[model samples]
Target: MGIIDINKVTYEYIRRDEDGNVEGITTAVNGVSLNVKAGEFIAILGHNGSGKSTLAKHINALLVPEEGSVIVDGMDTADEDKTLSIRQTAGMVFQNPDNQIIGQIVEEDVGFGPENMGVPTKEIWERVEESLRTVGMYEYRKKSPNKLSGGQKQRVSIASVIAMHPKCIVFDEPTAMLDPKGRREVIRAARALNDVENITIILITHYMEEAIYADRIFVMEEGSVVMQGTPETVFSQVDMLKSYRLDVPEVTELAWELKKAGVPIKFPILTREELKEELIRLGKR
Candidate 1:
């Protein structure tokens, strides 16, 4: 079994009235099943209300499944005794860094998770040091979070999560609030975490560009995984992705458009260099 295993999980959102009446119900996750091995990079893409976030919640036991189970490293999230362990094994980083960062300083913020976990004072600082360093934020450890940019703050937020020493990290649109440069910084940090620390990463994002680096991409729609494959394979189906209310990366889209316009190129060009190479090949032809 993988480090994270979700088996036929279903979750619903219940609406209620002021008088505690049954108003309505929305099924956010519908029989979703998938697995993630240790130290793998996975991306989940979906439009708003697609239930990707809801599924992410299950990884750390934020929400137990209504009809199925989420198991992390052999521990069932539904088991109350395993809740803390599940969270420690699969830490989450949210979209907005502002809401997540609460410390007066960067290092202080990063230490919160370990401190709460009852780690030794000496080791808490050690974890804070390593986590910030892993995210390339060690130099700014003593700086006030308010003085940092969006991307820097997000990195700190990520450091906070990693300080917990989670086996896996789930990022819920972690770059949604940043500018282009900030987005790049945050994404690069995430890649570093996977490459350097060998931590399992589950990124829930709408930005297709971010998904390009993932080992595999899973597209969600109506609370289920509609497509799952390598980035190249999934982005190759541009029209199908569009039908799901999502998009391919920019380079992929351009190549797709060129193909549609009668250019003798392949589908799902993932990078600028690949598109360039293909055009050069066509020119030579």
Candidate 2:
């Protein structure tokens, strides 16, 4: 089986009134099923309230499925005994780095996960060093997290997760709180982890540009996956994605407009480079 197997998982929560009375139930994840092979980069895309975040919670067992099962590395998330193992196997990096970083020093923050897991003192330091270096934060290891920028702190948060040596990392909109440059920094670190370390990455983001780098993209709408395919294939359906209140990469939308205007441009132009080459070819013809 793949490193993550989510089979027809369904999750819902009861909405309670201020008086502690049950109002109604809202189904956040509806019969969603997908698999993530080890060492692959998968992106989950959806606008807010589309259930993307809810689906992500299952990968590491933060939220158990009420109807189906989420099996991570062959262990079912529903099993209470396997919860810790599942968490160790799949680490999580949330949207806000401040919320995740809790140590006085950078290295201390990075080392917290392994230390809490009862790793030897020597190995915790080892992991801290390796993790900081991996994210290009080694030099800043002695500094406090409060002094770092949004991007640097996010990288530190990532370092904290990697120090645990998890097989997969779930980034739930890890770039949502950063500026453009900060967002770039976090994405670069994520790509490096997937390329260099071969760590499986499951990224949940609404940024269309970010999704282009994924091996496969899953588009969610109203608590279910509506589209799943290579980035090119999924982004090619401009109209469909629009209906889901989602946007494609900027270049893709531009190319779509050009195509509509009879420019004969190809569908799903992911990058400016591709669009330039397409225009150059058209000029030559």
Candidate 3:
């Protein structure tokens, strides 16, 4: 089994009326199954209400499956005894940095997780320092988070999660509210965590550019996984993705259009360099 295993997991909630009457049931996660090996960087993409967030919540035991099971590091998320360990093993970084960060100082906020876990005071400080450094926020450790930019505050939120030393981290639309530069900083921090710290990362984002950096991508629609493969394989099906309300990278879409125009360009050009290389190979430079 991989570090994270989701087996036919299904979750649903009952919609209630203002009068507290019973309403219809909405299934948010419908029998989704996938796995993430240790130290791998996985990306999940989908339109809103496609069950991406619900599926992510299962990894940390925030939502128990109504029909199937979710196992993280061999611990069933349904097991109450293992809930704390499972959450510690898979920390979560939510979308809004303002909501996630509550520390008076950056370092104090980062240390909260370890302190809550009953780690030694000295070790908590050590973890706080290391986590902040890992996210490139150590220089601002003593500063108030309220004074930092959106990206800086988000990095501090990530640092707080990592201080718990989770084996994996699940990011739920972390860059949705940031500017382009802030988005880049968060992605860079995530990549470094995977490469340097060897932590498993499951990133759920709407940005195609962010998904391209993942080792693998899973596309969802209506609470089901409709596509799963390497980035190149997944992005090549431009029409299929569009049918599911997604767009490929700009370069990839341009290459696809050129291919349709009989330009001999590749269909899925993920990066600018790839498009340039293909055009040169075809003697169109």
Global CA lDDT of candidate 3, please? Answer: 0.94
lDDT per model vs. reference? 0.94, 0.94, 0.94
Q: Model 1, poorest ten-residue lDDT window?
A: 263-272
> Which regions of candidate 1 fall more than 4 Å away from where they truly are?
none
Instruction: Tell me the deviation in Å of residue 45 in model 2.
Output: 0.7
Estimate, for each residue in 1-285, the C-alpha lDDT of model 3 and write its tens digit.
899999998999888899999799888999999999999999999999999999999999989999889999999999999999999999999999999998899999998899989999999999999999999999999999999999889999999999999999999999999999999999999999999999999999999999988999999999999999999999999999999999999999999888898886766889989888898899955
Scored against the true structure, residue 221 in model 2 reaches a CA lDDT of 88
lDDT of 2 by residue, 75-183 (tens): 9999999999999999999999999999999999998899989999999999999999999999999999999999999999999999999999999999999999999
TM-score, per-candidate, Cα-based: 0.98, 0.98, 0.97
Clashing pairs in 2: none
| Candidate 2's TM-score | 0.98
RMSD of 3: 1.2
Displacement of residue 225 (Cα, Å) in model 2 is 0.6
Clashes of each: 0, 0, 0
Clashing pairs in 1: none
TM-score of 3: 0.97
Question: What are the RMSD figures for all models against the true structure?
Answer: 1.0, 1.0, 1.2
